[model samples]
Target: MSRESITPNGLNPDRETIQLGKLTVPRLFIGLWQLSSTGWGTTSVTRVRREMRRHVEAGYNAFADHYGTAEQIFGGFRSTLPDPKVVVGATKWCVFAQIDITRSVVQAAINERKEKMAYDRVDLLQFHWQDYSDRQYMDALEYLQEFKNSGDITELGLVNFDAARTDEICTQFPGLIVSNQVQFSLIDTRPLDGMGDVCNKHGIKLLTYGTLCGGFLSEKWLGEPQPDEYGGPMTPSQRKYLDVILGAWGTWPLFQSLLQTLQAIGGRHGHRSISNIATRWILDHDFVGCVLVGSRLGLTEHIDDNDRAYGFRLTPEDNAEIEKVLEKSKGRELVRVLGDCGAEYRRGGGHE
Candidate 1:
């Protein structure tokens, strides 16, 4: 559908918000991962702040994961708002190196996020640990739990954690951990291997990213030829998903077939675009609490098209049509080939 032809209604809180642990958040979150690196280019502080306000006003209240100066920028914008509590920002405490985990050290890290976001308490604090060999992550979580008890953090979550480790943490922590952030999309369906079951068993919600496959699942790429992954115009996210598409999932022709199938199914549902179809497909799963779609902040916005992904349910036939294309590819084999939800990052599989 053309930009002028696409007419989606305003955001509905009833349809969009879900009970994520102790907090109620929009089912669709504005991802700040793009602001983490310059591989996706940069926007001015003023422009970024303006876009942040625009997103919250449109009812996309939840923001997920920040790196670089995103926290400061978001903090600045947040301070100017009349009601900062309306915006929910989730930041990460990623431990890339083994350290002597101390309560003071962990408290200092939490303090930094609190200071950067200009909020006394973080809405959600998502944690990631690179090396599972070290058992100190437990100590870190122990401190985080203490802070949570003290009301310095609202809720706790995980990022890129596999099923076994996730189960371990949840079993150890019980009801304290509420969500697990992982890569879940039509192209990267590794979560289906076991993460979904773990989340269900533990009553944990899966907050997903890369649902749109970095814009590769949109109408713009429906009939186009594959671009040079390392060449002009491909952003960091596109490169990451493209590597999975070409290397593991299937050929470009097969991906095109999947896109064509999505386009046809979308035509049946009020002429919604391919992106909406993909987003709705992921959101259909009962275990999914939210799908984090990357926003370019001031550079680009898809609020209208994204809003359509909600308030509508995909039929069984729509799912059957999608699965037909999926069964023809090697999507199911990703779990074995790439390991679990986060094997690429841990095993040097070159997925960015």
Candidate 2:
């Protein structure tokens, strides 16, 4: 509702930007993981292209993808843009096999990502290691550091890595790692437990996801009854976050209470939505460089609503009200169960 000047990309002139290594990107990144049609519902290529354009037009110039088909889809669309250089691309590589740790194999993986994404060099290349027990991840990072030195990768990052491991890596490579992508929403503040401190000490930033809890944090679920198992229409992301909501966050009824509280707080700030408030809450954190919101592309659109997040600031009373509800929630225990950021995925179970 604020009369802020709009940029050509549809971004508010006041919207902030962050430095991820050498690339400067918007604080809100369009998450392309939904582009992969395996877990998330089907999405047409046309929709994907349109959605990317929508984000760029709206002033969100950064996109994040994993090393899956998402890279291919995003790259394919990016090539068609009038000015592709305006977009900042970040992707992840999950090390699931021992071969991926070797220098030759790692180089091949990098080359494959470049070819698949149709980019000469990736702005940020985040690595995800399933088995921390294997020291091959260290070797992989060493190789990635070499690539970063040679300019094949603009920046090196980590996905779902814990604070201890992050610290170890920082000690090993100093300023090579710029960011760590993790799930850090109001419902899951695991990063604040220790990861935040580590990042602060090491000058590393956090790019957070799961902030909206796969749309559950939105107003659509307000006052709704808990869906019976296999009864309600839900996407894979919703189902996965539902487990987190029910498991460590709180019961369904309590979640509804929190949603109602968010609605009330948002109303005070020019009638913002629950999702916007949830995202704004994470963005307010000093350690967070950006928040990644899942974009379902053509199936659903919330660009206007999302833009509202940066329109107003949350008051201290708003934080107090949210915290009052959180005090009764099981967030601490949830962090314990989930371990550190990205522990669910490493355990062989998590939202895709």
Candidate 3:
């Protein structure tokens, strides 16, 4: 576990893989949400496949939360591997509208994913429900369970579901669900409220995203002035998380203080980058399973910097110092202000 002992293809196995049902996945997952749209920029399929190989060789073999042509592109890359099972791929079936939750409807969703991925069964199928009032998500989940029973899916998970519903659904289907994907970061401490306890009670693992706040939680933005949301080089993710930073979490000045604190903590940990410290803070929690880092693939990459996230743990002094800045902000009050983990999406703040 020492920093000097860590290798490129080797990492702390315990920290590298977390239990996700019967399968073990890397602690860090490569998120393909950027591939869902051109807002993050575009690249050739050849470069993307090359980047996927680089990630695998670098010890990150799990991928998730893709959309549009992401699944198909991932399918092509996965086929090139010697053994396809060497990688873990997760796809989503999001219901943003009110529709009948039929068995065939569920089958068709899975079928399309499988056909796109060129696999007979999906490695992981995450479900997202937009409207909580409809309650048909339960029906969809029930049918998803039926698919699992028939071996159409190896694992079932939730995307942007609140803690209350996560607890309820897990109780209704005991020992069925494996993971719940949610937004968890230093600024957005909503998961720390009730979601942590719910995950513990149900034996569920949290696949967390926005751990770096859409690349805002880094040294690049440490002392920089807040950019205008209307005119800037900010990506879609940056725009979304910027609202959380300046609007919900705290003022721009307070966030700068946090970044400084993180910088200091990173200095204590042998000058690890702010992103490493931020990700380490989340991975340190026992309830968390993986931190999903969004990568623009061919356009850009942080594989080496991100790889440094492992082989280090935050000390009590480090956390205490980080919390000093957090106390001045609205960090702990996010759950009350924004409801639960997925309230940002449900409350019309747009998706994470």
Q: Between 2 and 3, whose lDDT is larger?
A: 3
Return the candidate ranking by lDDT, descending.
Answer: 3, 1, 2
Selected candidate, larger lDDT, 1 vs 2: 1
Task: List TM-score per model, in order.
Answer: 0.94, 0.94, 0.95
Candidate 1, 265: how far from true, in Å?
A: 0.8
- Candidate 1 lDDT at 293 equals 92
Provide the lDDT at 142 for model 2: 93
Off by over 4 Å in 2: 1-10, 349-352
Worst 10 residues of 1 by lDDT: 1-10
Model 3 spans with C-alpha error above 4 angstroms: 1-15, 349-352
Worst 10 residues of 2 by lDDT: 1-10
**Cα error, candidate 2, residue 200 (Å):** 0.5
Worst 10 residues of 3 by lDDT: 1-10
Predicted candidate 2 versus true structure: per-residue lDDT over 7-71, tens digit per residue = 36445766778887788988889898776655567767877777777777788878898735788
- Clash pairs of candidate 2? 9-57, 9-58, 9-59, 10-58, 11-58
